[model samples]
Target: MPKPFKIPQSVLVVIYTPAWDVLLIRRTEADPSAPAFWQSVTGSKDTLDEPWEQTAAREVLEETGLDCTPGSALAPHLHDWGLENIYNIYPRWRHRYARGVTHNLERVFGVQVPDGSVVTLNPREHTDYQWLPYDAAADACFSPSNAEAILQLPHYAKQRLGTAA
Candidate 1:
């Protein structure tokens, strides 16, 4: 049996902390020969109709072994940035989608965790992880979208905490 075609709709989650420390994960060397590039949690929906929040939660767990369920003990907060980016999928990655599916829709989200939170990364998915300040995380991301998402973390963090930015 063939693997299921990937859903075009995906989620980009910027995991951060109230103190503005952002979590960045380094992708294993494979897809690109470039140095291990950093990025936040990102993944596609499991099915065509899955909710973006569910996709965010699942990706967070699968990538970092962190729980973002509605009310988990850690209660790592989650917020949908209410922004979506639509762009043509990279040529090398288009094969994961159905034939002729050249574009993808990515929903942006932010997850807030405590300072110095222990991160258990899935070695198969991420070789290393780092907690950096908002600006550093943004600069470290290799993907434009991922970097942009981190750049917006301060704004969302301020709004979420009832402060003006």
Candidate 2:
């Protein structure tokens, strides 16, 4: 089947806990022998027809098996940092975009849930998942852009928690 014009736009939702720990999913590497790598729940906008918030919620449900409305209150903590990061799309996923498109614009969001909430993950996209301290989560990511966004979580958490910044 012919691919649709690559939509370089996307959203990156960092599901986390009150303690600044974020969820990480291990993606299967291209090399069959290579070990999987970690990442957040990220995906491109669905055909530019769906709203970005819809895309975020749909991805969350599809990747983690949680039914989340576009702006549902999973917890009291919710944040839109208005942070955008651009980076080269991984070679394996580059095919999803238009030809010659290298970088993708990722909008950042944070959704906090109870510390040990169980998650149901889609096996095809991720092999395993973990909730790690923000710093550790950042280090675990394969993409520098994702790491930088993870590092910014504390500030957003504070704002959402109403803690003294």
Candidate 3:
């Protein structure tokens, strides 16, 4: 039996440290010759009805081995940024969704992990990971939406730290 088509909705979770270094992971490309680009943890929901927060937590764990469930070390710091982006799906990846589906709705989130947190990449989905300062990370992202989201990190961080005025 064929796998079900992916939902057009997904979550993008930016994992960062207290010092403002953002975690970016390089995706594993099927074509070895394809250029690699870094992105934050992103994944579609298992089902259309899955809660966005649940999807965010699951993607974080699956992509980076970071547990963000309630009572977990990163749980208290998990935050929903209340931002959303609607953009056209790149042609190369649109096949994952049903035919005629050309757009995606991405919900944004941020999770603050302690400094020096270990990131274990899932080899099947990602090839490597790095923690870069937010500006640099924004420059490294291949997706414009991802880059824009990284650029907004300082605002979210300030709010999370309760320093926003």
Give candidate 2's error at residue 88 in angstroms. Answer: 1.7
Residue-wise C-alpha lDDT for candidate 2, range 57-151, written one tens digit per residue: 77877888755664556623445668888787778777777779998888887778777777998988888898889999999887777888899
Which is the better candidate, 2 or 3, if ranked by lDDT? 3
Local error of candidate 1 at residue 46 (angstroms)? 0.7
lDDT of 1 by residue, 1-165 (tens): 999899899999998887888999998744676766899998999987788888999899889988987688544488899989988898988888999999889999998887777889888878889998999889888888888888888888898889987
For model 3, residues 45-148, the per-residue Cα lDDT tens digits are 99989999999999999999999987897888889999999999989898899999999999999999999888888999998889999999999898899999
Q: Residue 34 in model 1: shift from native, Å? A: 1.3
TM-score for candidate 1, residues paired by index: 0.93
- Arrange candidates, best lDDT first: 3, 1, 2
What is the Cα-based lDDT of residue 140 in candidate 3? 88
Candidate 2 stretches with Cα past 4 Å from truth are 3-6, 29-32, 71-78
Positional deviation of residue 141's Cα in model 2 after best superposition, in angstroms: 0.8
Model 2 RMSD in angstroms = 2.2
The 0-to-1 C-alpha lDDT of every candidate, in the order given, reads: 0.87, 0.79, 0.91
TM-score of each: 0.93, 0.86, 0.95
